[model samples]
Target: MRISFSKREHDLLERIRSGDEKAMERIYNEYRNEFIGWGVENHSISEQDALDHYQDTITIFFEKVMNGTLQEIESSVKTYLFGIGKNRILQQFQKENTRLRHEEGVHEHYRFLAEKELNDIYTSAIEKTAGMFSLLGEKCKEILKLFYFDKKSMTEIASVMNFKSEGVARTSKKRCLEKIREEMTKERNGG
Candidate 1:
């Protein structure tokens, strides 16, 4: 059976989509603990594991909705959260091979859906790293910010950063980018 959201919940979802932090906080508070409890009871996940899954599910939901990928929900936000939480728990189960007895039918369905959804979230997250040049050393940061965010050419960036030549600026940018990629990979792998 399909679940429905009340008008207030629907409004809250809209607020979350619009980047209202308070609405997002309210949504998190309303569902996070309940989902954690559900995860612990049904999936045999530790309390900490349940909390991590809950936070990750909420983060994924927020990212998708804010990025305009997940437009609207037919289910109440609570039901949607539970669905995401179920999938996250199944993912943990598959990875850990914990001997937990979940209802086979529901587990199978959620596992399939969660794998796809999490893959999309992961992809989007990786793509977001292309902007990491902004976090490099101050000189590199300024040069890259001017080149990318400010739409400056190599010549312009060199002049802005007071480099001797465009070649030097270009090489610095390349090395900085490599450093950013290394950092991003380290972050993704939790190093």
Candidate 2:
């Protein structure tokens, strides 16, 4: 059964949904510090990580409200913020688990299972990364997929991506790698 919200909490959520900056500020001010403390004490997240998670939770909450998915303020705003923070912390743990599993070699049986799981995770991550490339208005996704996934050389990718020269393609590929690294860091840091 869903918990019931206080009248004031419901009103605050409504104001927040309506894009009231004051209401948003009130909610953030009410919960940010306690959520950060909880993240650190319970989840072992670093101070910076806690801060980032708190901000992300607030952002997600606002997005949910705006998207009309946050239909009922069935709990205290503090409870909702804590719930978001908990989920974000757990997501970080899952990503770390996936990374660690990849780093540590496993037995054949485990390896097969890990490979399958990793492929599923990697495919989803790459699709999201590809979407970002689409937003950049460049052929970065195709070039990167061919170079990395297809294991093609710069010259080959240049031919495919229609770069003027292999040198230009190499430079572009290097820049793309840097961008991917940045994206990976963002993902790791729960951004």
Candidate 3:
């Protein structure tokens, strides 16, 4: 049995889309207990672990909604949140072999939503990396994007970037990546 969002859910989803903080709080409050309960009860995950997973799920949920990956819900927002929670719990179960009980086709409905989320993750990753890479010099950006984003061969990159040979292109790309890494480290360390 499918469950679509009610009118109130539609309004809340719209507010979330509009970046309303109270809307976010409302959704967080609505699902906090139920999601944590499932993780703690079914998987025996610690409360802290459950809280961490819930936070990550919320991030992914916001990413899906804000980035336009989620549209025209086939189920209630509550159901969708549970589906994300279930996936997170399963990841833990795989490692520790924690308590997991399931019946046939139980998770089928959530598959579409989860798969849609996976598809968005790649694009979102690219956008995120692209943003960070933009902080580099233009030459570094071009070289790195050519090698990583465009997937151009070293030989091709050498020819395009006017490097003497594939060896030179490879060295240049390495140095460019190192510079980006150093910048990222400094940023993370609050340099």
Candidate 4:
């Protein structure tokens, strides 16, 4: 790609323009480690990715010089290299984020299916219990509904049902639960 090499840093620019391998090597050696370190600390980019990015940055720098796209080096070589590293690091992060989002969406789909299956199991169990509960006496049904379904306290059930005391309400609820348990057991055991 065409780049306008700036004239401000002509010495290094001229070296690069002449296809001087030493000049390129010097730049690579000078900043490669520093760039990689920065990549690790700031961007969390892998070492290999950092290496590849740095090389691409250098390549772009030379292309800018050779093609005369860069009229001058408006910024220092180090600054330009660092800018390229930052851009490449950002690209890596964006790609990683996109991948994670896709995985999360797939997991969400599976999780939704799992939760729906569990809910269906619970709903079936409730329906079965409701069918059996229909056989309970009116008093038993009222006590169970007030205590369990409505989440009423023993004292509240005693007040509503006009039980002699909270103890009576508790006793009645316990007896009703025991009867339901017996029926459930008999049904399951096919007695």
Candidate 5:
């Protein structure tokens, strides 16, 4: 909607355009608090941010007036200033959102790196454990293969391995794991 400026507002703009510093100051002073309050209440902007945007808004208004770009107004000066202030707040929010996204991207990159490193460590440990498996006696190897790769219960393992009982199968599995751990520790200590 195109609304013509009031005579007084038109005169104020003309005076500002003519380098009338007092007229500019009057406009600035008149709108500063109101703009800040409106920004804080309506836009959820903090007081300090509202004040900064208000200053920027006034500067933009003054610049337009001086540059002959703001010759006429379709709204009240307060509306114009508030419009500028709202745009500034939106720009600020966009900037903040962009920064937050960048930070999240950085964090995601680091998380990926950490996950890859952890997977590498786990892969290396599995490779080392496979190598250690080769050093086991045939009986221990058969017992571990039955319990793990064959997915056998302790009763089934004992029956297949000809152990006396499930307890013997459990003991054998425990001993196999302990031997692997001992060998791994020795390799780590450069033994």
Candidate 6:
């Protein structure tokens, strides 16, 4: 690769080669923001992604220069660096796409198993509640079945159960529910 390396760039490269850390830092600061902005504006990458890619790009460039692998470039240093960053970003996207494709079936299968397990738990809890429910007094059972299973209004329940008013039926339903809750709690506590 042939880089139209400027005299300043040549000097910078020489300084870096001579183990000048300040020269490397200077080069890093010089292009960091520009690279990030370019990545965001042109590639639609997040700022953090751009920053990370830029760091990687800089690292790769430093390694190549230090190890004598990248002897020359076919363009300007900025262009070369951007090219590396773009390739890395595209590679990441490709990897994410491949991962999603592989995970789709696994995800669906797990979701199905999760739903089945939830349903089984719900059925078990309902069966337990029903068992406890049968042990209640006939009056309590009738009132609960009418209000819950039959979806009867408070006024309707009051009329059916011969309560004084809708308010009395409401209170009775509340008390029945409280009794069921207490029973369930006792059962849970191994009583």
Considering summed lDDT, which 10 consecutive residues are worst modelled in model 6? 93-102
TM-scores, in order shown? 0.51, 0.48, 0.50, 0.43, 0.48, 0.47
Cα distance off (Å), candidate 6, residue 183 = 66
Give the poorly placed runs of model 4, Cα more than 4 Å off.
1-9, 93-191
Order of all candidates by TM-score, from best down to worst? 1, 3, 2, 5, 6, 4
Q: Give candidate 3 misplaced runs (Cα > 4 Å).
A: 93-191
Query: Per-residue lDDT tens digits of candidate 2, residues 1-191?
Result: 67877888888878886679999999888887888888899988898989888987898788777556677766777788788889778977334544345335433445654567775655556555656766544677667756754567888888877899999998887787678667767877899
lDDT tens per residue, model 5, 1-191:
88988899999998997679999999989988888889899989789988888887898789787766688878989888888878879878434553345446655766653577665654455556678787788988988877665467999889988999999999989998888877767877899
lDDT of 3 by residue, 62-171 (tens): 76665456766789887888888788788663344221232113235446534556646433444445667767788888887677645679999999989999999999
Q: By TM-score, how accurate is candidate 5?
A: 0.48
Which candidate gets the maximum lDDT versus the true structure? Answer: 5
Candidate order (lDDT): 5, 6, 2, 3, 4, 1
- The candidate that wins on TM-score is 1
- The whole-model lDDT of each prediction reads 0.73, 0.75, 0.74, 0.73, 0.80, 0.77
Q: Which stretches of candidate 5 lie over 4 Å from their true place?
A: 93-191
Tens digits of per-residue lDDT for model 4 on 78-110? 887798768767766334544346446655776
C-alpha lDDT of candidate 4 relative to the true structure: 0.73
Off by over 4 Å in 1: 1-4, 93-191
Better of 5 and 6 by TM-score: 5
